[model samples]
Target: MRRTRITAAIAAITVATAALTACGGGTATGNGGNKNPKTLTYWASNQGKNLDDDKQKLTPELQKFEKQTGIHVKLEVVGWPDLLNRILTAASSGQGPDVLNIGNTWSASLQATGALLPFDDGNLGAIGGKQRFVASALGSTGAAGKDPAAVPLYSLAYGLYYNKKLFKDAGIANPPATWSELIADGKKLTGGGKYGLAIEGANNAENIHHAYIFAKQHGGDFFDASGNPTFTSPGAVAGVKQFVDFMASDKITAAGDAEYAQNQSLEDFAKGKAGMLLWQAAGVQLAQRGMKADDWGIAPVPVQSGAPGQGTQVDTMVAGINLAVFKNTQNRDGALKFVKFMTSDEEQKILNGKYGSIPPVTSAQSDPQFSNPEQTVLRQGLAKSAVALPQVAKESQFEDVVGPALKDLFADAAAGRPVTEDSVRKRLEKAQQQMAG
Candidate 1:
């Protein structure tokens, strides 16, 4: 996961200043008419290769969208670290793209600014109504109970990926289905400087995803249906205990793992230095290309204490980017059309197949590769048990706070310091107040 270069406080201040400078009220379009060769700007986050490679993957499809609608799209891909500043600056100044791909967590925050045009129009329903996509995927990209603030593009979900050979070597015939079993397996695998699990206590993104899985397993969450913070509940305590204990427990995660994030864990796992890891689907390719074929395989995350809902995990990156029309776009209709086309069933299938992402639409699951027996495990797991993270516009800030906050608590726990619900609650309460600001 990429770390923010600037502190959240400084970043927020900088973004606010930029937003203030960018503020303007103008017609969605300029005096120039939306005619023959209207160009629509679209900003997206950096994914593969560089802007060039992304453009290549999108050029043909974009051309199709433009040719069909008589509008050309100018693509701009920015790295995640700089994307927030760029969008806020452009949006406040009325200079953003006709359509933009924003991180799902930003939807609520950006939408709350009232700078985006809602697709309450017929365009959203025409491509695929809200019902066509996975409810959790759609929910994650929008204001949870409100009209969707953004359209879902592609999905990502995290799972426990294990070294198959390690399990076989330990005489573990079946994957661990519960926390108890996981610990037992960890004991069997740990030795010779090889730990059983690799977790990211330092990376905020990875921490949030891990927190979600743990909280869900213990039957707690970051927020209730009303969107209030609930991070100190008993379930949350259990979740945190399990997470911290796994890292501190002898023969499991190393005590020094607090300084390591997902990247370190991935490198360790890819190098076969760890027996198991929780990570995104992208790790599949990394492990396959980087490790022996028979060395590793993927599995649903383990459950808590052999309780019901075995092998459950919360899905992140399950949320897809929504292409919102900037209120300042000169071609709102064209932008809307392009948004519809980019998230259409055809385009979704193509992107998901090639990019290793889950399609935003439930029907897109029909694509044979996604529906295959091997892939079906994750698909069904998501469909049956997946919960979307809190979609409150303030979630990005929430992440900024809760990540470091948890790191502090988990680090202490790993170092043999007492960690109680009160300590966790105190930190979370402080974070909640900061986000409220």
Candidate 2:
């Protein structure tokens, strides 16, 4: 899930989330998925470079599960573009996998549908207990003060990744620590065919993520305590404007980046075509792309003022994948067993290690294998400054509406159109209107 902020643009989730109705036949419970308890259908998120890659990595693990439990897991690696839509469909249609992976941010929205098996005290106890999961990770698993709708699997937080060699070549000693510094340093690094920063301008999720953090940096909150949309608040308007200015005014980000939806910005950073990127847990991805670990440095995402911390200095969002079971699965026991197997310390290490994510399971997180510089910074962020996106039931609706709104603003900037606060507020106001409608 890469925190749900670092992946595909979840277009049209408005439709899927709107369609949810507890479960099949408008009831909170209905039978679906594999009929046999000895077998389970699984829809894993596309965490690897591609669907095939995820299949290759997970097959052996699935096989091991089968060998140990005699329950065969039939797997389908679903890509980001369609993962949410698919799950929502299953939740409403009474036809889906018994076990699936969801973006942890979706826990509340899906929980509202009552299609997921709630990890209450008893259910969580059956899956090795709730205390094993990280507290921050657990914070995003549904709304506040309720049993988690899903269990945390892979945990992540955003950070700024910079090319050390590029920095040295540009006579820069350290990464920028503030927004102004980032923009100024970026300007210096923007000559000749290299840009100072790479951005996913057109990706809806990416756009909303940056906006959310920028808003937090300026005392902005996307929703009121009652979960009403406040998208056009002064903090939000400034936040959206400041993020887009990297392209519109700062010129450190390439205009062509407005067309980027795939990991082109990431590719640019990894290939040294760009000097920097704001990302989540990218260590394994960079290494896989042949960039040496020593070639780069990781730091907290730049903030508006002082060091990253609570309130205005908040930087990253709590990100990662969660394991969920469909409420109406016929193979309930096997599904819970599989969840147990996946969250167990052994598999937590293996799966999160391969995916370059921090394990949400506390015992697994302490593994020395996860003690590298990147993981260290991310763990700190998670512990100190990272915030989860609003944990409201309509949170997915927020992403669906606001994310595209930000994408449009980026497009305007890329097209050399005016991107004033008025325009930003108007765009967000329309989004709020959509939410109200």
Q: Which candidate leads the pack in lDDT?
A: 2
Please list the Cα RMSD from the true structure of every candidate, rounded to 1 decimal place: 4.7, 4.2
**Per-candidate TM vs. native?**
0.81, 0.93
Model 1 worst lDDT run, 10 consecutive residues: 27-36
**lDDT (C-alpha, whole model) for all candidates:** 0.67, 0.85
Error of 1 at 321 (Å): 3.7
- Candidate 2 lDDT trough over 10 residues, lowest sum: 1-10
Clashing pairs in 1: 22-92, 22-93, 23-92, 28-329, 29-330, 108-393, 109-393, 156-317
RMSD in angstroms, candidate 1? 4.7
What TM-score number comes out for model 2? 0.93
What is candidate 2's lDDT per residue for 345-394, written digit by digit as tens?
A: 99999999998899999999889989988999999999999999999887
Local accuracy of candidate 1 as per-residue lDDT tens digits, 272-361: 778888765544355434775456777666765443343344433354466667664556667767777877788889877655667877
